[model samples]
Target chain A: MKLRVIGAVAILLSVIIASCQSEEQQEFQRYYNGGKIIYEQRCQNCHSAKGEGLSNLIPPLTDATYLKTNKAALACLVKYGIKETIITINGKSYEGAMPATDLAPVDIAKVLTYVTNSFGNKMGIVTSEQIDKDLLKCK
Target chain B: MKKLTGALFIILLYTACKFNAADTPKLPIYGNRDTASKVVNGKTVIDSVYQTIPSFKFVNQYGDSITNKSLNGYVYVADFFFTTCPSICPIMHRNMLKVYDDYKNVSDFKIISHTIDPKHDSVAVLKKYADKLGISGNSWWLLQGKKEETYQLGEKSYLVAVKEDSGTPGGYVHQGWFVLIDKQKRIRGYYDGTDEKQVDKLRADIKTLLAETNTNIAQ
Candidate 1:
């Protein structure tokens, strides 16, 4: 009877843990789906559907190292365009200007979350607060 | 035995239909908006010769004057874009680069990029823009001409739309079509410049046109 009671408690704990993980996953999914719609409308024209950018013209977002290194600049890039700048990714150079988008802070966060977490990346979610803070520090 | 034979017959018929569907029809050659007749051994043959691009003058990236005659006997792709466009021009420009890379080796193949906003994209600006994009030589010519003439060519010759709109993100608006012109200066195909898959199809069709031209020369 003692062993039976312990097993019941263990099973209950596992169920609770799994439910909590799934809920977090569901929240990420909501952000991802919302971000995808916004990305398709605003970014897909140049970045492409799969984030595989054009040859030497637009830089690819699938590059995990570049995304991680330039995470702060990305928020600014989305809100304010980068002009006359040379972006080097994986030994290749691109010199195209990314025009500024007219998206809100929430939308910018969602888009950042989507791109960072997608295309062979899992960089976690970005909140509106983070985007607001980052935008303030943009050069 | 009869049921097996029926199934086999159905399968054969389905394969036959699939084969037929795979055969693409020859693309139509458009002619000038005029019809003429000729007498071929007393038979009235309607001779509607293929229409060609109208003669026009424009300045290339190197400030060299380029006319329709200069581009004769070459297969070329043409599109219109501006330098500072914040909308679809970037996507179109990227896809055009792909087409350029694919056919850059062919000596007679060229790509023409016309700017509708001539006031901003002058010869110097276009030259600088071309250098920024790492495009050298005459393989890709970024042409800036009179705005009205360029818009006319876009509408009449290329069969694409172009206009200035204030409400759009970019001040100017134009279609995203990459037009394929044959050696004879006739439009052979049109592909969406914003879609990579469609650009791939355009590349394949260019090969088909080149092969067809070779076969004609041999004959």
Candidate 2:
């Protein structure tokens, strides 16, 4: 199909383009790009494109302090979803249930990296290995 | 002599533009219509009647009874949604808030959202949801009533689809259409509630309808 050919060319072009960059930079680029698509598809509806969240309903993801403090638990929150609990974000308490996703650990890391990095909070790339460790500690 | 004719031509062009500007764009009336021939003043006359939003009764978020008669004079937008909808309802309302903010102060404009899942989304639940979504006043009313009546009104009158589906995320399926009804209770347009662009178009069309009615009353 035409779509398959275009996709193949895009992948090949990316590989050639990424050859110039270091391994670490390439890894981050891959995760960041992949995470952007995932975030737009899954989280953009509620959190909004800018992660500003719905007013008094869904909590914003722009709280850098909250993301930093709960860095380890982010994976669990994305994977298992949030229950009926009020959490304070940016000085506002939001109560609602977030539907759990069936995404794998790597997806969790990719999306987390995208969320943290783009939304005025830069915490670097969260790897699948780190996500595996965090999932074990989910409570 | 040529200069005088040029000045006259300029005046003619100005009048032409003015005439065109005076004629405002109008929204097309949507829905089925029928014509009946009758004798008036000993002459046979044909009159066309457009389909309108039929009579229905439901309770708003404030527990006040809302009938089609309640919205008789006001131009209103109608849509079907539930509180705990996980898929499209959030985005639909988010986009709708833009329209709400634009016309909240306008007395003749209103928005009514009927709930398809009346059993779970009771009067109290709709109230809470409205509160959380920053909705207040009579401008926007979230109505809840018998499930069958609500679904029938949405599908039959508003021309939007509504059904109960357990396999879906929210356990119900419905189109995210913001149906615009004129002061005469006829549908003017339908906009995809989930898309910001379409919602923007809906607001523009609302202004057109309002202007059309305002001029009619002024004349």
Candidate 3:
């Protein structure tokens, strides 16, 4: 009788945990899918579809360390566009101007979430709330 | 009804013959052509005069003057773009880099890119751009010249539309065409440089042209 009661409680706990995980997974899937469309529309040309950039003329997004370190600044960079600033990535200095996009804050969050998660990166969802908070601190 | 059947049979046979003729792949010669008739050894000889690219002088990224004569013995592809085009130039060049990598080792192949915005894309700027693009040696040349000269050469010789407009994103309008020129300076083919499939076809066609040593096959 005690084993039966324990089994019932264990099954219920497992069900609750699975449901909880799926909720987070569902949010990730939503952001990733939405961000993929935005990436293809806007970023694919320069950063490339596989994120292998076009030679030294453009910087590759496959560098996870760069993305991780510059996580806070990425939202601003995507929204306002980077000017003729020389940025060093993969030990090489690249000086080029990236045109600005009119993507909204939430869309920026989605796209950032997409880029950071894809391209050999495992950074979790960059939420819209976090993007809004980061935008306020962009230099 | 019998006559109609015979005519339809003949038409089908003719179309089949045309399809067979097209099986051997050959790049089409573009632009207008005229026939020249002359008497050779007391026989009436008719020859087709193909439109060829005229000679022009321009400076390359190395600050070297490159003219049409330098490219006489080599098969070359020509394109027009500025260093700072925000829209299609990057994509065009990105596609073109495949062509560059494929044929960079061949001594008889060359790629020439003319800067339509010569005012900003000077020799130094072009050189810097080339260096940044990680392109070296004479396999590819970033040519810059008088803006009007480049535009005229682009529009008239290559048959590509190019103009300046303030409304455009880059302040200039141009087609993303990679014009393939044969050793004889005739326009052999034109590929849309922005599309990967077209660029792939361009690469394949370049191989076809290189293997096409005999003049009779092209006819």
Candidate 4:
């Protein structure tokens, strides 16, 4: 009888663990979905839903050159502001100023993660740890 | 009846195309500014593209040397950003991604990004940021150098303004305008990288630039 009881307990435990795993997956999806919301509220103004930029003024994050080369710089730009800077994109020169924003680290991570993933930008995840590292530099 | 409808549709399409073509006039390759303005403290009267894009050395995301001389005779799009910007950086980057892909095939054009927060946006950090953005090779550059020089370039050469505001939580504050420089290094146009209408204007300007490259000046 005790052995049978043990088997039943084991099965129950397995079922619970499986449910928990599924729940975790759902939670992650929520976070990703939340990132989309954030993108619409904040990112859509400057970066159109299509990710096409405003002429020669802004560099497109969807391009492989930026996704491949300036991941860290991109992060810093999102966290801090490019107060006075000059950048070249697609064989053009632009001297513009970008100010820092006031989003938290997690929000920054999710938004950046969204940009890194969207617009043909197939790049790795930008974790909160990486955001923290970039934030430290901003300080 | 079906054949008549199809013929009418074709005629309408052709008329629309013709109307659009006629409505769009040939704008200058780079925009023209007729005013004599003071970029700096009542000194250095600016003229044309020849007076802009002066030679200066700065490090790329990979920490390589980049100078105005190095980029001579090339068309490019340049903007400024740091890794930690919270508001428009992501949006600007999203649009920039499109610009990069659209022009990735054009060998004569390149992309440049300047770090406004130089003290914090170092080469190593910029490299990591570039990596996250999936930027690789020589197609794009994230540059950073002295703060004053960059500010001057933005204010005078590029004709944009910048300043730092520690009172604001972000430590540094600045404008969000993007300047378009021509092959001859002249300030051709200014666009709101954060605005959609302005971006469309930029796209049209780029198309104009490409078309004008093959045409000779009509003196």
* TM-score, cand. 3: 0.85
The stretch of ten residues in a row with the least summed lDDT in candidate 4 chain B is B24-33
Stretches > 4 Å off in candidate 2 = A1-20, B1-25
Candidate 2 residue pairs in backbone clash: none
Clashing pairs in 3: none
Residue A19 lDDT (model 3): 81
Instruction: Give the winner by TM-score.
Output: 2
lDDT of 2 by residue, B90-120 (tens): 8889998999999999989999999899998
What does the lDDT read for residue A12 in candidate 3?
100
What is candidate 4's DockQ? 0.12
Worst 10 residues of 2 chain A by lDDT: A17-26
Q: Write the residue-wise lDDT of candidate 4 on A1-139 in tens digits.
A: 9999999999999999887787546654555666677878766654567676544544555577856677776667876766547777666554455556677888887887778777887664667778888777653
**Candidate 1: tens digits of C-alpha lDDT, residues A1-139:** 9999999999999999887887668877888889999998998877887898755667899899999999988899999988879888888887767888799999999999899998998998888889999999998
Give the residue spans of candidate 4 off by over 4 A. Answer: A1-139, B1-51, B217-219
Ranking by DockQ: 2, 3, 1, 4
Name the better of 1 and 3 by DockQ: 3
Write the residue-wise lDDT of candidate 1 on B79-151 in tens digits: 9999877678778877777778888888878999999999999999899788767788888999989999999
Q: Compared to the true structure, candidate 1 yields what TM-score?
A: 0.79
- DockQ-based class of model 4: incorrect
What TM-score against the true fold does each predicted structure earn? 0.79, 0.87, 0.85, 0.52
